[model samples]
Target: MPQRSAVSSATETERKYTAADSGSLPDLAGLPRVAGIDVDTVELSAQYYDTADLRLLQSKITLRRREGGDDAGWHVKLPGGVDTRTELHFPLDGAGASSDEPPAELMNLLLGVRRGMPVSLAALLTTSRHRHRLQGSDGTLLAEVVEDDVVAVRGSDGAEVNWREIEVEIAPSAGSHDMATLFEAIEQRLAAGGISRSFSPSKVHRVLGDLLPAAPELAEGARYLRDYLVHELHTLDLSDIAVRRNEPDAVHSMRKASRRIRSAVQTYAADFGLDEALVDELRWFGRRLSPSRDLEVQWERLAERVSEIPVDPYREATKTRIDEYFSAKSETARIEALAALDSQRYLSLLHSLDTLVDELGKTLPARRRKSELNPEKLAQSVAAVAKNVDKRVARVLKADDPHERDERMHRARKGAKRMRYAIEVIAPLHPKRTTRILARFDDFQDMLGEFQDSVVSREHLLDILSEQGHAAESSFGLGILYRLEGEIGRQQAAHLEPAWKKALRSAEKLWA
Candidate 1:
């Protein structure tokens, strides 16, 4: 059986003043009362692990076996807010006990990844750490000493271990000055030891760990298309996590991610092997999630706006209506979105997306070249994405009913974002053209977004009023909010027309 528990503790301390000009430690004058002896020491070697895709490392999990410290052992640092690492300790002899497999407690942390694939033993390193402590204004025990670490890494193949060092810190007090003092003190100490600041960004890199391949160098057309596709896939993955967590704005965020991915994939059909039917299905799923997400954003926005309005004759009534509408809609939308996520189709889509990403990663290498960005090709690609957005918007405009119109409009907003992102990814390649295109796209997206929000808020208000019994006096406020949303929608539509024309023109000039 594995021992599993969380111990909560608070830390507070300050580091002594360091040299003013050198940013190094100064002598401690009237150091505060030390309640306990804290050793300012250094730790040298630490190993890290991850999956083939660098999951654990990306998530900031560190597994290391260290020597030369009083608390040295096998340490698995879990992610949390502060430098407060959940240190799991073991004797040096205990190394082989879990060498072949991860402990059960650690397994829970990697639940998102599939089981049975051996956790890749990625990299090994030696880290040197210097420690320090701080006291309160009065001579009283506040926090313990901190550590500055210098690391040397043995490559994955047991080649050479490159040496680098960084500071691993903890505070005795929450104050920033104390932290700064400790940092200065440690730097001075390390400088005296002939250790300098490491040029490596992270200890993992210093060790020569496996890294994701750099983005392919492609022609302007291919690069824009590739990055656009990659962004969509990335968004989909983000939404998956948000959906699984059931976060407050998860549905909306997930829906946006999905729509963006689908739109981009569809627009750049020649660049990727996505099935049109599959993309259509994803659009359907996004539509299902939109109402709740839209309602949430709308209410939050309108609530703020309404608060700014003076106490007019209808101010109180408007607030009441908006409140009632959102309360009921939020509940219903959440329930529906969760149910949709549980469907087999949704699962299948997720699997398909994962497969698509792998396929793209494999195939893109063949089509790419190592060179500068081509302006004309990038402009053409942006035009393609914008045209896709135009089509989506046209479909939404054709929808007769409010529900259908709102749903399609949400999809259009996603299409606009993808178009925007496509231009953004290649902005470096064709700075002038991409900038102008992005600016216009942003305006179009903002208006559509506002319209969607109003639609969602109104729905939520209606739901609330319905549930609370729609008596004239009881639910009168909901009606006012709904009316306000309708007005807002009209205004948003009026604003969007000229923005669309400008964006279309920008794309054409570049493409031409």
Candidate 2:
């Protein structure tokens, strides 16, 4: 059975001196000295351990076991600040015992990495430690000191090695500058002892132990796609936390992450498991969040731009117009968006994403063997995405009424965006052909984006007016903005027709 005990902190004091300076020893100065016995100031050896998932690397955790030292044990060091390491110790004897792994208290610190994986013994290091300490102005507690260790290495094979080194670690209270001062003093003393600073940072190369194998290489494209997805996922998680805490801009950040992930899915569908229908659904959520995000961006942009207007008349008018526009109906739309995100539908989408990620992780590794982006295959994929977008657009055009048209158009914009992202991915492989497709897609998307932004802004302005008890004022401005937005949409639609025709011609020519 293994027993647990808390290691008490002790105050230490010592001074480092070189062999040449040993003849001119300074008096105790009211502190005791601790010295090593018959230990040559040479180099040492050690090896570090981490999980295959790289969780420990991400968290900056260092796990090592050392030999040839009076205090050889399992050392788990968690990152503190710039210069501090929160070191935890476990006796070497219980390392093989099932009950002797790192304490349960450290589980949370490990995150999810060590949950099921067995901790294997990694390396053996031999070290000799010379300990010391520094005192405060009144001889009270200040900082402990350490001078270490020479000659460390790995492997069981008996072979001669050449490396020499020393290290000085100060107590946390000593501060960075104080630590630098102590290091300089120690170096000067070691110089007198006929010992110089080792060229290497660690003594590990001097010891003998079994060498660890290098990590296997992953498929380049797949790895790039996965890294991008992981970053977006982490951003989404952070945004969720910010929203829960009611932080400013949290909703906007969350929406952006959702959009980016949705884009990635469409872009890398060949590499990852992405269903066109499912991606459309995710885009629907992104569309719902867009109104809030757009309003936020426009407000900030307009404010910055309007501030630079040299004429007071132009500046005041622009500011008033912008303020009145945003003040209308803005609260209601923001509230609705937030409520939608909190709804069961949104949560279901999030849960689905989690499941998708897990499934992809399992299948992606196996599919690495078949990973290739042939131009013919890519052209077919692009055409397929374009066809999907056309279908959605047709539905919007077929709607009989304005309200239905608006809803369908919104859906169509999402489809167009998905197709556009698909083209973006293929652009790298078939630049000229993909460029033509993307150009058409862009024109269509920009028009739809404009239409949606107008609708959202009009709604917001009305809400703000209603809140201010100026419904009439709000209505008049909303009407003007609405009409203007309609004109913009009509203009865009007219331009897109020619662009789409050109795109089709180009796609056929290139693929032919």
Candidate 3:
């Protein structure tokens, strides 16, 4: 078996500033609880790597092989929060030190971001650092302030640029609140010397200027939709990370993001070049991740209802068995979900979205037989969906048969998703009205979702009970829960009419 490296990481929250010289590095003794400053100096050499087009850079991810630092190793930094990035470090091994090939473990972790692209060394940078460790009276380390004098050499050209910068790196234990105050105090001390936070996103970005995509001339609608699409893509990628780590809500969030992306695609079908086949492929993942969540929901609802009645040992034992069954099934589903995200096909989806965003950002001419959709026309689509939603609403309200009502309600739910996604893409343009409509859709979708869940729970319960080897109480308890689901479902059905009527009536001429 190939040695698998355990995933190791730290939250790196730091601020950077460009300086003319490190001769004026700030003294930390003035900050709160500072006892003394311990100074350390080191010579650091590192080589940064990225894809040919710099996909990793575009995503704000950095991979580097470095030496001379106390904890020198291979580092992969992923964009996290405000001034925070998740830094993963691997020991400097033969492959990384001798050449630029990153380890397999690190490469697998980045499959979602790299999308099968080859990574090449981009820049060679050497830094002379003057590190100041701020310590409290009690000897608690507060923060590390580094003054870096950097010389960057472009890999393509032998051109070298020399500069100096200041970095304020907070101790992980210092916490965000302390970090913020300390950072600001340091900022103020530096600002007095005619220095401010650097505008450049990263040292690599400053060195490899113009290699990444430039600012684009996207139209208002295209820009709004593209921003949303990019957000969903990020959400999807984060969910992938969560899934790999076995986070509780990963599959559920990923599935919801995929559904929203599909809805947005339909709302802006004419906006830009989008792949229909790719959309279908996305749906596969949502379905794959679904069984676990669906079963979890059913298990909770059924158990809650069954627990309300008098306890029965027979039913208790049966419940344990059912729980075991669902638990095993959910685990299997989770494995499948992870597999799908790691698959070649799913990697292609990320690549496709990257391409779509790139093409949409080009100089204004539509491609793939789709025209440039006007921003104002988005309102017209809203009005059209409103009209169709009203029809679907009325059909669900009038349907008498339970089976038929569910089918119509399902269609109505889809209509609600379409309308809400349309407005969501442009909510900032007309916040007040679109915001109100989206809220109404939220309530309507929830009701429909509840009904659908009850239906699924019923089917699952019946199927489970029909299997061989059941005690009287097992049958009795499950049957009671099953009937209660039907009853509760009927109650929800009765309110569908009023819910639809109110949502549709509140938004008059949706376009207006």
Q: lDDT of each model, Cα atoms only? A: 0.58, 0.52, 0.78
RMSD per prediction, one decimal? Answer: 7.5, 13.1, 3.7
Candidates 2 and 3 compared by lDDT, better number: 3
lDDT of candidate 2 over 1-512, digit per residue (tens):
53444321232222332223123222213432222212223233444444543334433455665444444555555444444445665555652422335543333233322323344333344544543445555543334433453443323343434332334455446555666565556556556556554443223322322243233344444444455566666666546544533457977887867776787687567645566565777778877766666777666644554554555555665567677666554565576666665566766666566556655555434334463633445556657766776676667667887668778777767766665654554455556766766776666666677777655544544554455444443345444544565565556544544554555555554345
> TM-score for each prediction?
0.66, 0.46, 0.87
Report lDDT (Cα) of residue 92, candidate 2. Answer: 55
Which stretch of 10 consecutive residues in model 2 shows the poorest summed lDDT?
31-40
The candidate, 1 or 3, that scores higher on TM-score is: 3
Error of 1 at 110 (Å): 4.5
Predicted model with the maximum TM-score:
3
Per-model clash counts, in order, read: 33, 35, 0
> In candidate 1, residue 346 scores what lDDT?
70
Candidate 1 residue runs with Cα over 4 Å from true position: 1-38, 42-49, 58-128, 134-164, 168-208, 211-220, 224-255, 272-292, 302-375, 385-415, 468-473
Model 3: pairs clashing at backbone N, Cα or C within 3 Å = none
